[model samples]
Target: MDEKRLIEQKIFNDTSTYNDIMNVPYHQSKRHLPMNQLDRAFQFAPFGALEGFNDLIQEKTELYERKKYTTSETELTIERQLKYLQAHSLKVDVNYFNDESGYYEHFKGYLKSLDWKKGRADFDELSVAILNIRSIKLIKK
Candidate 1:
């Protein structure tokens, strides 16, 4: 009677149109195994497009959490300890702020040299600015 009814009768109610396909049985391969729903879902799941991006983000967040403001007293104490360690050539554990990354880094090594004029402390493994030093202690053997 109406356009909607006409289209529905011609398409949906047309049993002969789908009868041939409906009667056909599903085909299963003899060699290949069927995939489970979980495995099939994983095939279309989203993945990380940029490698190492997660690690970089995690490192940044950890740095932010570890960063702290240093006081003048703390700097003065570290400087004093550095001078003593340099004079005695003692093995030490040091914590210093890295300006580039805005995080504190630890070093456990002998103090190789200290330049008061240049304001830097040279360790067996690395050199750090004196002003950036947060704390320093002798590594007891």
Candidate 2:
């Protein structure tokens, strides 16, 4: 019989002999040799390669989707600040218009017509102060 066929027949027919052959140090060493080299090569690759691949994929998806900031927290914050500034400016305008002696009564009428629900308490207080000053000025007039 050929050597290879003899070994194959031994492996199939003799369990103890097959186990001894498999347990040999030379065969054991060969099993781990390639695996150790593969592990070392993977460890030596650049640290950011995997991370860069993920980032590149994310950027491409964002471009494909045309990602936007419509619902972003910062955008909402900026919109709220703009509304507050508009309300605050209205309060300041009412105060400035009320400061002129002749326009006091007209300013009081305008203040009464404003929607205070959308404005801050600071704006409300400034508006009230303007109305009060107008009242005083009317009394003096």
Candidate 3:
């Protein structure tokens, strides 16, 4: 046989070296109980070395993906629609820019009230700031 096979044969033939310990039982700790598979798995689990880094990256990505808005382009259209809708309650779909998330949010609900002095638009469920409104379309019943 080749060198590898010869070595394996020799080792297999000579089992006396490990024979003393071959039948020895495994040792167990008395003070601590054995961990379950899941508990043991968590011992080798990966951890976040840099806390809040993911949140920072997400905030940065949202800022880059934000849609740019100009008052000149949409102000006149939104104002006219607002004036028309102010007279009566109506179901409307509104797309407005969210300053907190730097994104546009779509809201569909019944318009309840509008405050010109405070610059706020109240819906049945929630209220949105007037200046942040991008487009407002009345839902025809």
Q: For all candidates, what are the clash counts?
A: 0, 0, 0
Residue-wise C-alpha lDDT for candidate 1, range 16-66, written one tens digit per residue: 867779978899999999999998887776683566899988887776676
**Top-lDDT structure, candidate number:** 3
Please say which candidate is ahead in lDDT: 1 or 2. Answer: 1
TM-score of each: 0.49, 0.20, 0.49
Q: Report the number of backbone clashes for model 2.
A: 0
Q: List ranges where model 1 is wrong by over 4 Å.
A: 1-67
Expressed as tens digits, the lDDT of each residue in 77-111 for candidate 2 is 43454345544443223222232232333232222
lDDT of 3 at 68: 61
What RMSD, rounded to one decimal, does every model reach?
11.8, 22.3, 14.0
Candidate 1 total steric clashes: 0
Reference-based lDDT, residue 80, model 1: 77
